[model samples]
Target: MFKKKVVSLALVITILLLSIIGCTSPQAQKQEENVLEQEWKEVIASAKGTEVNFYMWGGSRTINQWVKGYVAKNLKEKYDITLNMVPMDATDFVNKLLGEKQIGKKEGTIDLLWINGENFKTAMDNELLFGPFADNLPNYNRYMNTDSKQITTDFGFPTKGYEAPYSKAQFIFIYDQNKIEKAPYSFEELIAWVKSHPGKFTYPALPDFTGSAFVRHVIYEITGGYEQYYNLEDEAEIRKKIRPALEFLADLEPYLWREGETYPSTIAQLDNMFADGEVLMSMGYDPSKATSEIVKGTYPDSARTFVLESGTISNTNFLAIPFNSPNKAGALVVANFLESFEAQLSKYNPENWGALPVFSYDKLNDQEKEELADLDLGIATLSQEVLDKHSVPELPADLVPIIEDEWNKIVGK
Candidate 1:
């Protein structure tokens, strides 16, 4: 009789617990949690000892060295993963992926690549990228500010978790402090200065990265503002709206270097011309580029960087996994490692890459915050406060190629 009563009481307790919780028992819930933990472990286990092929633009020596040195070393130590960084233009890689997709290739040579703006849009549109996988990164969960516009959007298009924000860049004009007492503060001031100083100023010709950025800034200041262009996708309509900015460029052309007959073909050439004293100012998308050049002894100590009072445009670059990557597991681990606090800190140092980190300052713990605060961003880099104060969003991606093509016809011709 006592055993029967004890068994009946246990059955009643089980029924009550299940009724309260609507069906899941405590043991069942625990098992589900264990399965989730196992899944994460499986991902890590699969990534170990694999080689990840990372494709990126091979334009900067400092960037190349940092990747081949610091990044490669840490990944090998932590995950036993071999990183092979392939240097190539982002467009070429995107096109490569498109070719793979068209042929229904199940595997591709690229594990990951760097891109932003239109290139990223093209990849997403063509379904050439892997996953909404950014949320899967451990470091991304802990350190990233996903709520921020800088992370969620690239050039007015939603990222939708397709890529992880890598670094931040803003446009700034570098000038010889010894030559110009004050950098131009507005389009009007810049034009006046250009007219007075003949053959002393010229941007890199269109189709160049930094050169296109300079044109975007001109559009922002002259044709109202950036927000207006986000929804305006019509090509002809955009041309009409930007006519004034073009006229402004045309009016200043004759005073440009080489009498506006030609322009520097690249931002590097423009920087070289400035260093050689052929032009008074050089401009680029990187705020710390002047600092990097000075450190290399290519630019004089007199070099300084400044942005327009109307604010310079800023954009975020990202890393994405290719759709057909044979090593998706390796790519995930590598990307997670890159977003770690250690990698971000190294990339921030001028001795390394000197690019702005994508992590929010508030997300950092006290020690991490102190480390970031201690980095000497070099003499030519602007204070974060100033850069933030004058920072503007980039124009929509679709509008960029239009600006480039039209500039070729009007300003370049």
Candidate 2:
């Protein structure tokens, strides 16, 4: 009787141990929540009472209000940190940081910033950005590691965990569906459209993101392949190969733009022109811009998005902290919140904001996805599959200027 009781007790102990192990296993818990809690506490402890000043493009009133609301509500409630959104254009942010460096301001006024592509690359090259701290972030795993193109790379600048990607956008061709239901399906067709409808299509002036992206749009098409375009960063090779593209643009220029003498100052200007009936179409980095703008009373209700048959470049923008930031922990909290599923969903709702969510769809639940489906989504719903099928040209920093200068010379603007 004693031996039977001892054996029974041992069996129960073994079962309990197995149950505990199984419960904590990767397949069982569905998340590594333990690590997150530990890291969150550590981050909070390190950044207890600091305020982070976030600088970003503040052109849109709706986006500014959205930022204000998110910062005021969540950061205070959860982290007891204050976030101040410093509205500065991208160029100004870079210029300020460069000036600080020149004057030896080790700790500058700028704490956190939103940047990507050329701006992010310039900051990284100049060593104006802060830590290799992204991997240490508590919610880092919620994102695909820095290896994912959207997370790891910026304008061919490898992030090296320096920046956290917040959202995705793409340079898409825009047109009126009512006047022209059959959008141009090829670059050749686009050229044909310009010839068919002279003075109807135009991109913003040089140095503008939309216009620069339009230059890249042409580069990706004439290069014959996406991989080749990404790989050919050599200055001489780029100039030589891109000549055909420049020629194409130069030829298309006379027919475009009013008198082909002056161009709209910015994509926003181009959008305004389109709204005023000066142009039939405008360019946008955000494929959903038509819907988002129309909802906000910026663009006409009839506007829509389209893609050339060869496709356009899709890129992700990111948030980063300066090395001299006074509120490192607060910045982390803000960046993490921006990447959270809740924030992303709110951003993707066309009626709400319509910014593209960078989070992979596989990571989201059925309920979350259903919300996306139920959204009064924009008319220009480019399926993720179709978007993934498109090309994303990662040009070398040097070549950006070459294309822009040529664009200027072509338009004489």
Candidate 3:
């Protein structure tokens, strides 16, 4: 009877060991991998016929038209995806996301956002965005300049696949060649030009994106270069470093339009002033903006765009998914399509959008290369070669707000 009991116990132990092996076996691991692949396939399949809500700034009619007419139509026909464009300011959207996070809402309406710079940093820091998923997109993998610092960094913050490059832009000053014999090519020249032609030049007020960028351009030109501030963390140190730029702006106060007592409240107002001959010059973040404005009859046909000798600031804009986005797969599809050669080419056309492409030239095929090279970027717009040659890196994301605040205190006072 004792022998029989011992044999029974040994048999039970053997069975338990076999069960443990089965649970962790190679076959079991393969099965788990298969399940994950199946789920990914389901995500793609589910994306079909789904509506993707894209939230972006709605101030530009041209951009809105491009989305509604071109982007929306293409998505529907190709992927059976509906593009529901929602116009919302980035700050407002960030606040909305924060509110949603506070209330613990897991499903959000915003599938994709047109975001970059400090706003992107804010979303990332608050854990309000989704994924290191940019690498997973086939187009991004094929066409992007993954090694380029401009593509990987957003205002000095590493993107880390949190955002996908959508477009490239540079700050350019616009002047009617008919009105001025020569445009200034440096910040010192700009001050002299403003002084010589008092009441004919002024920038939009503080906090306006373009105006803020113009201030940064001045700061970069005067504070030696942008390299020193790349790793600088102290706000006070930054203020001290940029004090000269602020002082220069204040010194130019007597020469600005309305003697700088009041300035144009928005870029549009400044642009209109330029158009109506109220101001001799206007500036924009878009290099092709002057050309588009001329075509739209807002500016004279002689209006031309130029960057300063110190090189104007340039950066890549990006698209990102919200953390609780309801249609992640669809958003991915839209983003992937946007980065494709076809979409980028369309965007590059001056009549369509005139936004610069994000694709690397070497990665493109011969036919694509030929087509892109042959495409006209408009007469008033500077060539890509010129823009690249004169490009300056944007200041760090944190430094931007600090600069804006200081401008408000000193220049805005």
Over the stretch 199-269, how does candidate 2's per-residue lDDT look in tens digits?
Answer: 88888777997888887777777666545655765667766777787777776777887746677879888
- Cα distance off (Å), candidate 1, residue 361: 3.4
How much lDDT does candidate 2 score? 0.72
Tell me how many residue pairs clash in candidate 2.
Answer: 1
Least accurate 10 contiguous residues by lDDT in model 3 = 27-36
For each candidate in turn, the TM-score is: 0.79, 0.75, 0.78
- lDDT tens digits by residue: candidate 3, 89-155: 9999999998887766666678899999889999998999878778867789888879876788998
> Model 1: runs farther than 4 Å from truth?
1-42, 58-61, 87-89, 107-109, 185-200, 253-265
- Sequence-dependent TM-score of model 1: 0.79
- What stretches of model 3 exceed 4 Å from their correct place? 1-51, 58-61, 92-96, 99-109, 186-200, 253-265, 276-279, 360-366, 408-413
User: Residue 26 lDDT in model 2?
Assistant: 43
lDDT of model 3 at residue 305? 90
Error of 1 at 288 (Å): 2.4
List the global CA lDDT of all models.
0.84, 0.72, 0.85
Compared with the true structure, model 2 gives a TM-score of 0.75
lDDT value, residue 276 of candidate 2: 81
Number of the top TM-score candidate:
1
Q: What does candidate 1's lDDT look like per residue over 178-237, in tens digits?
A: 999988887779888999999999999999999998888888878888888878877899
